[model samples]
Target: MSDVTTPKRGRPGYDQAAILEIAVLAFNEYGYDATSMGVLASRLTLSKAAIYHHFSSKEELLQLALDHALGGLEGLLLEPGAATGAAIDRLAHVLRGAVHVLADRLPYVTLLLRVRGNTDVERQALTRRRAFDRAVATLVTAARDEGSLRADIDPAVVTRLLFGMVNSIAEWYRPTGPTDAAHLANDVLAVALNGLRTPA
Candidate 1:
């Protein structure tokens, strides 16, 4: 007598992951608020019931997508490069990892950046995002204290500026574009860590 029943399958070729991918793409293409189960079903060419078989609601899909993006970011902080290095190096590692995450999971990360906290799921994602930001800010502070970073600028402002640049990549970066993630990360670091003003 096994209490665990086997999970039911949805329509062939449309597992939960596949459905989630399409749903997140829709959420990014249209506004999440405007993307309903009906809209997702129409996009998937499946009945609403089939969609429900995969997800309980649009919000569930959203929560999963947000987690997908946030998880990538949060994991970066725990990496060896991020954890056991000089703060400046750690910061660089995290930023580079972010670019890779964005390149690998573009739609999910895009949706994460666009979240407005309209729902509980959105709010939770925003909270996790803020925590990530704070971690970066702390690293900035450490690097500054070590005299590796400019101290004149506030660390919080530096964090904002650094991430502002990193986040902007989502707007223009294309996987098919000339710049790959490693080169883009290098360019970002060169500009951000070094500076436009030539040394005297």
Candidate 2:
């Protein structure tokens, strides 16, 4: 037997994606401005130097987290269903996709939603978010033109209302919750496109 027993190996090292997930959770819990690299290191049980090995600075981590959230939303626009269907159907498909992205990427989406244009990274995220909103509004305009959506509401206003409903999910949605994304998407479409009052 050796004079001393071999020490057990420590936890596996974290990769960029794993670090990003932790960073998003920390940022979500303590707002990006309030979080620091030291705080993140403590949360991750790694030294500041170790974290620096992966990310140059806290801002870099913020950017990567925003990219994760924005990528999901941007990818939704490129899907075939979003581009080829009837305008109303496309609009519904996009809304459904948005809901799924929100639920699946809840922490990152929540962080993205909370950004206030205070920093360069945040401003860029906001710009991307607004662009996505505008794209959805275009679908609303198309749907209205097809007489499938209510013309009484301006497409811009409809776009805002639709997203307002969807974005509110970040406040209360949970991945482990009873409701899944598909059911939530259907509920959203029913209320948004079909309205609340029963047809007489």
Off by over 4 Å in 1: 1-12, 196-200
**lDDT per residue as tens, model 1, 92-154:** 899889889888778888999999888898998999999999999999999999999987989
Single out the weakest 10-residue window by summed lDDT for candidate 1: 1-10
lDDT value for model 1: 0.86
Query: Candidate 1: how large is its RMSD?
Result: 5.3
Check candidate 1 and list the clashing pairs.
Answer: none
TM-score of 1: 0.91
lDDT (tens digit, per residue) of candidate 2 on 1-200: 01111123344787766777788889988888889999999998999999999889999888877887888899899999998979998998899999998998888889988889998889999999999999999999999999997778889988998999999998988878899888899899888988877976
Model 2 score (lDDT): 0.86
Best by TM-score: 2
Off by over 4 Å in 2: 1-11
